[model samples]
Target chain A: MKQKNDKSRAGRRTFLRTAGKAAVAAAALVGARSVGAQDKPGTRAAAGPVEGYNWNEHRWAYGIDTYRCIGCLRCVEACKAENGVSLDAHHFRTWVERYVYLEGEETARVDSQADSQNIAASGSEKEYRFDNRYKDKKVEKAFFVPKMCNHCSRPSCVQVCPTGATYKTKDGAVLIDHEHCIGCQYCVQACPYGARFFNDEERVTDKCTWCYHRITKGLMPACVEVCPTGTRIFGDLNDKESEISKFVRDNRVQVLKPEQGNAPTCFYIGLDKDVS
Target chain B: MEQLFHVAPYTGYVYPNETVFPWTVMIVVYPYLTGLVAGAFTVSSFYHVFGMEQFRPVSRLALLTALSFMIFVPYPLLMHLGHPERAFNAMITPHITSAFVAFGYFALFYVCLLVLEIWFVFRVDVVAHAQNATGLARQFYRALSLWSDDTSERARAIDRKFMFVLAVVGIPAAHGLHGYVGFVFASLKSREWWGSDMMPAVFLFSAIISGVALLIVLYITIAKIRRVPIDEACVRGLVYALWGFMMFTLLLEGVEFATLVYKGKEGIDIILEYVAHDLFYRFFVFQFGVGAILPIILITYMVFRKVRGKTFITVAFICGLLVLLQVFLMRWNVVISGQEIAKTMKGLLYYHVPVLGREGLIVSLSALFGPLVLLWIFTRVLPPWLDRPATAGPQ
Candidate 1:
């Protein structure tokens, strides 16, 4: 019986290794090289689906409803309070972008900037001024796109870290372990969306954790809680009954740069065309 | 006169409105490669300048590693640049005010130094058999001499003068080449992580660590392949050099951290928060924990016990590989993490590594393997180390 068990274990190991190698080879042959590097299912299976450690089982994702967004700037304020984000103009955990388009009888104009803090001051009158014309009833065509970390499912930052400093938690929320980071900055370059940021104090990398500390305890993320218009929605994406899941399932949702093949978990329902 | 003076208009459209290759990426590959070059050159200096006799076997190997890697320094930057063709502008009409201006001169000085040293060392053999070489080898060796008379007396005189001069100048060039790469990132004002003054020193020291380790591995592999007796004494001395560099590097980083944490700048706090809890595992575990500390411990044990065996050297080689990997991670963290903080001060941008893709592990492995292949090709024709001592008898 002992000999049989040992033979079975050896056979299993060989079978798994062969299967893994074959999968990698097939991925390469298909020209989707990125698919090969993802952690094999067996590797994930080894963790035994422990709570918080089983990332897929406890997915934490966010949805933003562009229609409901009031651009009140409350979420930005809340993010600062929670993350101890710097008050300076150069650093922000969350910010708003305003795109103003001017189309006239003879000419047209468009302007956009990523850092816009005083968005609330622009009332409906000012909002309509650009798109409104007395005769033609056209003024400024403008809208706001609040930008933050997408918390992608296949984060480029996590792939390039040689030390495994950046990882996805069991709940499918990507997080970084700062203690192991050596301040090398490989993840920064790997990111297609410019998400990762380096911390100056500890000489290491830092970025959004999807509020892992709060979300794991069943608290809404700071951004979601402070959003006065309920524009930002956060919940377990895996649960079909969760508001985020329902919105995504009901609406025509879009992920940024699907061509890049990151399969970003963050979804924007009613996303603007100029957002990316 | 009009035709002669009519250069292309400077619309500056050659560069894009926004760069696809980010600053963080440039910072990663540039300083990392430069560090490796400087480190390798320093290992060569141990034998040539300081006459650390035990390190003599790797002397040539060090020079070749330095030379080959130096060739690749321009590749990453060129690939990253919006108008790669305009790279020559740095040499032609260099902006004196720009810090990068020094890089052009640095490359020229070191290239000249390496050329002179290699020529002086190999001129006699080339002259004797210049006719025997075929194709590129013949052309290369013929061009290498630059039509100079390769007589016996002149060769001896040239070698003597060059060996001494190169030993002196190469040391400073090695320091400048790598240190200045660090200075590029260190000089940038926008990035908080690179703003520290200690970066250049840290980069230079780390360069030495990687360079020495690389040379040791190259030397051992070459010896085994050539069927030559492995020089135990040389291997031992190289380990000492590795240990020495690692010691200085560890101390320097510690002091840098202490100063950074103590000052407690606004940026410093945010940086520390991410580095401490987020990057802690990588910094403390792989880089310091396994890459640096473990090797140092093993080396110390060998040093203390006077243990001399192939196993000790192999362990050192493995440690050296780890050190290089550690430094690569160090560059990654510095470049990526620095940008992870939200520049607008609201929310951090999360970076996820792309699953297997062109820009993923394959490219990184290719960068390393590319150099190794170049080194192999370099050895076949150039023969980085002296197999049979030229002065042993009469060739």
Candidate 2:
């Protein structure tokens, strides 16, 4: 790094610049060409056709019904298998949060499959299982909140990516162009939902895309397909007859941490105050 | 191969993705290095723009210090990036909405400004060396002087005017660079610890003190090495700058912390817990007490007692070292602590500093102190000691 810097310094273009006033004024013309080539309208990494599907005609969204979740770990396994996510406790495209309130407990004892204890219980990072710590104690209430990328209308991750490598698709899913990400992980830090992780192997940031590959091809996200209880919902918001449309209309749903104003497209039913 | 990732150990519930620890110590070193550049430039400008004769002795040194540190400012950031080679993509195709989009422009403009200032300042030295020197060294100086050999009064006047303009413009360019770094952290709404409105001001004030403190330490050490009597007035000016800015930095930091607690935002519980526990020694004791308060109190005592000569220089030197450490700790507390606090607001993660490899203790320490090594090499070529009679003599 130091050698490269020195080489650049030695080869730097000299603009002779004898005029003091002109040199001072040089700073005034700082290149403010803020818009990137990809940021231009009609150039924003638009999705291509999948058979007869047109991304412009669809606004994809997802729904999570925590009440019906079984904590089976099947969705987590399917997501890893489908997306080729890093096999470790730290990286997850989608994971289930097990919120359990034992007797006399004021707060839910929340733990995810990524928890070290859970990782140890499963015997390997490739597999995941919630331990039985609360098996004997959680007699009051328990529910599993399946979490993934919200793909917000005003996604913080999209707003903070320096290279514009990750972007919000026209179809309403957030996607990353693996070819371009510099992997500064500013997006990872920007996400309030903690949905993003740096992929060390690829050296890029990755998150739950809601399985954009499958979704455009008229398929449910792998996690949703593998869900035993229909806990995860995926559909096009532009279609009134879509499952997500009814999921929104028939239920008093709320997006996670609405106070942030990212306006998440992922609607949740049976979400408790403690879910954040 | 480097360990793929070191998962942060946590107490309560934290998001699984957060366990990867998005930023390493390189991020902490990044801001700290940038702050040093800003601070050093401000000191150099005192002589070039403000024309403070007492500051003249160290002014050239300050300029060299700034340029040396400035040149390496992006090195740590590059080291942190997953694809360091594609770093220029930020400049080529910046995401307009990003707070970081303008970083390329700002840094480029400032570096050009600093380089121009250094060139104008050293033109006379370069001209003389180019005329009288031998071999590759002569060729190097000739090119550095832009192939010009003018050492006339007319050329000197133009150099002064150019240095003046560059320094004047550089004040904002310098402060803006540092202040923008602060904003980069502050603008993030996700982390409660970093998203403070006062962050930029706090960073700037601390940056000023850190720079002034660095000047004091370097000026004294260089003087000692050259076997010259340290310029008493120059040291006094630096001490005063250090004293005044240190107070402001301390107050701004204190107020910022107080406001964070008073507002008692959603994640206050964990913040308070972290502060009382892990942060007690690092933040309250080391950063606040021994590093800042002790130096401040000693400086105050020296000022009132009308301290002078070796006693004063020794005290000020100690204070300078302490203030530098204080500012470094502030950067650590802000950058690392911000990440250590879980975004879920329910837990704290322990960022384990790796012993060796890319994101490790050895690399981090190198990033922190490596600029001084560069500064030493810079002094040999440019010889930024024009104030002393012996060193300032004709080449």
Candidate 3:
């Protein structure tokens, strides 16, 4: 009975291996046929979806509705918590900017109070004073702009790194391979958006990862999850039904520093001309 | 740590991460030191390749100066790095598009060229010392001579030819050495102050000025210390060269500033405001006023007036010292002041020189003096004096 059982188990293992091979071969053939079909004359390739792994299938995008941001600082706190970022004000993966446009002023006075602990206290309702100089101006209009990594199509940091430690993923996120980074800070200087920083403890360049870990696991980024107003939108551009795609299509959006030609994926609604 | 970040007195909307200047005084020292090496090597080439006979007296000393400074050029950069041990990764796995990737290769190539040139220039003397000395000293000299004790006229001829060829090759290598440093700063498109096509030329000319000035000061001081008669002709030539180079550097700077002010670009207002409010003293008073103008006027007077005797030497010496200060301040302004203006174009960032920290003034001074000490030791090993007999014992 023992000999018969051993023979039966071996036979089952062989059958399973053969089935797996056949499935993989059939999948490869299908993939090849689809690719060949894409190349056929007079046929347009699909706009968004690329045939490959799940990562390659997705193209992530972020949208900010500047009108809706309340400058609550919750998203900033959530990002710091999720990433284990240092508590120092100088180190941040994301921050909020408050723009005050006084009546009859051509240039709006802009200040980003990313350091303040009491971000909940100051907003459109109550006039706040900062640096002893920014006393409640003759108020006209006010709004908040939250800034993070634009995650450019052609990232300057990746181009400037002496080692290929900083790279762009297939899912359109710029990431740093921390283990390989030499910490020369060239990337820090190269980034026009001021997105990159040298984490003293980690001994490597740090930047916004688009919350890569959670997104890859089919979860929303911590910042987006914690946002109260749905001001921060994160979704796959490849999926037409995703909120980010709909928002981007419905609203006229703009990226910061378009003159830089970085081709940033992060789009903002109601973007002010004063924003850098 | 918060105190360090808070210390930067800012005026408007600076990116939070930009409040603390990333590159510090150590970075400033790196370029200053390299400029010295490039300048000194160029001065040596004046004699070796250009056949400027007046520079002959100080040719070997200038080469030695270049080598001494070149050896320590990488230390400041290494210390500034977050991971000093992995610095070689830049060389082993260089990303081609990065301007900084050329650093390791340029440094290695320039050093090797200097070594070969120095060896060929000092071969005859080393051979003579090897023949007369005894014990380990003899063995060391013999090894330095590659165990070849041939001091024949034919051998001397070959050595001179090789030295000439190496010196010729070293001219562009020296230019590349400092020009590449300038390129490192200039290639950063993000920083408006540093991003200019004129940077490489400006750095190269300033390097020549600093080199000529330093050699003048060293030659005069060494002569005074040794009680040897000052080489008046050589001093005059160097002073004149210093004047010419300084004028050229100033012209380049003038063009760059004039264009920026005239063009009226988007960020021009903020940058100009930064220069006016924050850098008024350092940029205008020290670098342009006392450091540059004073030396240029004094050196010019000495040059055209055919000034001689104690007066000429004293004025020339003062001008040399001033030119060194000028170049140093220029590096400070270029490296530090460039960082002072935030990339946001909304405000200015201030940097306070730390007293005793890693990127502080003390560390910078140590990096500067370390090369001088090395040069002192190197001179003890192989005397740079052309007048000394080849068989004379080491000092």
Candidate 4:
């Protein structure tokens, strides 16, 4: 009887998830078609939602192990190239934040790869690097935390979008309907994670869509593929033997700003109090 | 040439995406203008809705002010839009969950209501001019009258009934639109500075004070310009209204600020630092001290001491000007200052207003004061003066 009850609950979950996916796929189809976006097959941002890819079969999620990150910033560079994000200090689809605690300081001093000092060190916004500001100081603790959109289940950006141009997918991705976007940027303000940015050239808000086109085609996101230390992880949550499921089962996992009630799909391991 | 983007200077660990502010000074003016529109409507309703005799002198002027300002209210939002061509998208495919869905509908409905009310109020004059004038002016008046030249008591009775009903409905429509603007900010839980239950009330009360204050300045200035006698009774009535609304604005603003501080949520430390340092002069010194409190004190003194003649006009005029500045600063503090406090809560950013370009200082000023240009034209065309005849007929 208990097993039957469990099976029924799982069935309900699948039904609701399928409905959400159908709506997303329909909207994406309408948006892409209306915009007349030319599909040059094999690109990360292929014109429309991928054909023959069933969103109902997969539940996507991301995981990060801060302990393994070395602040290499290769993932940042790779993400920009793969997603066609602007090469500037202010707009980043993915970034690495380094938290340093020197002796006698109770609070950690956090800076990202886009920090002005780091930008000056790298000598170009095209390349990404972290500055060596605290190398000589006696460090109490240090760690590099990779950051990206959490693709929250209850995304504020989706809620506040006046035109319904930005939406969250059933397979776990929050994406912008660029063609329909009025470019008010209210979504940019509503995002607590600061993951969304305004695309000045296009006059629209842009963000990391978890490389939707690649993922739908069964390829890894650019950041996950390039991480040297296996710091960033991406996998299907539905498959019992998937890496993300195993990672969740074996370790103590946490999320950034759980108090925000965003219900983020991105799980983190070894997150410090100062990470947010 | 246009600058594609302007990055704000920041300190500490702000999100890289936060370098460029989403909302600009034009957003600040958007709410400020809406506040004045709502406030001015409330003043007009004092005569129309509640039948206050003291308010009769400026009632027509008040309605004209509301209409003129309401017409230009959407100008700033359009100027700040990334795609001005798609400005109607919110109206066409408005997202239901979004707080912004009702704004376009509400503004359009309210504008229609205002136009209808104005038409009823001025139908007699339009008919009178249509019968007496010649050539272009005659054509204009005839068109304005919708080709009807009825001046009978029965026709006017229907006009009075319609005008009163429109004013009764307009009270909620105007105030609701302005309050909804506050709800837009309050609904966003991302920014601690904006997320508050009292935000709508605060915006509504401040709007009332600002509108009443504007009426004072306009009433006295227009009288001086046209060389007409200032109606002491009307000025006195408006002063009482301004003073009363000022009390609510101060209390609500003070309580809201105190509650924000006392709650001391996750980002309270940063909010405190921002309030003390970055927002000190614009918020504390000028907005609270000069704009709100000072006017209350001066008006109270005038009311009790029975300050008469030029002294009464001078005091009321000064208070009106100060409150207008105060409300403008209040909007700046809410819209701009709220954005300055980063979402990270670990840093703050400073936005530099540009002198030229679309979202620049010049464009913002035009959006702010352009309605006065429209108001001047509206007054010439409609002539909303109760005591004097409107552009006397040929007879």
Q: Please name the candidate that would achieve the greatest TM-score relative to the true structure.
A: 4
Please write out the lDDT profile of model 1 over residues B243-264, one tens digit for every residue.
9989988888778777877887
Off by over 4 Å in 3: A1-54, A114-136, B1-7, B390-395
The numbered model that scores best in DockQ is 4
Per candidate, the number of residue pairs that clash is 88, 0, 0, 0
Model 1: residue A176 alpha-carbon error in angstroms: 36
CA deviation > 4 Å runs, candidate 4: A1-47, B390-395
How well is each residue in A202-248 modelled by candidate 1, as lDDT tens digits?
A: 34555556666556556666667656555677788779878787767
Residue A114, candidate 1: C-alpha displacement in angstroms? 7.0
TM-score of each: 0.57, 0.92, 0.88, 0.92
For candidate 1 chain B, the 10 contiguous residues with the lowest summed lDDT are B9-18
Candidate 2 residue spans exceeding 4 A from truth: A1-52, B393-395
| Candidate 2 similarity to native, TM-score | 0.92
| Per-residue accuracy of model 4 over A60-173 as CA lDDT, tens digit each | 999897877789887787677666677788898789899998999998999986688999989998788998998789998898888988999999889888888888777878
Candidate 4 reaches a DockQ of 0.61
> Among all windows of ten consecutive residues in candidate 3 chain B, which has the lowest summed lDDT?
B386-395
Q: Rank the candidates by DockQ, best first.
A: 4, 2, 3, 1
Worst 10 residues of 2 chain B by lDDT: B386-395
Better of 2 and 3 by TM-score: 2
Tell me which residue pairs clash in candidate 2. none
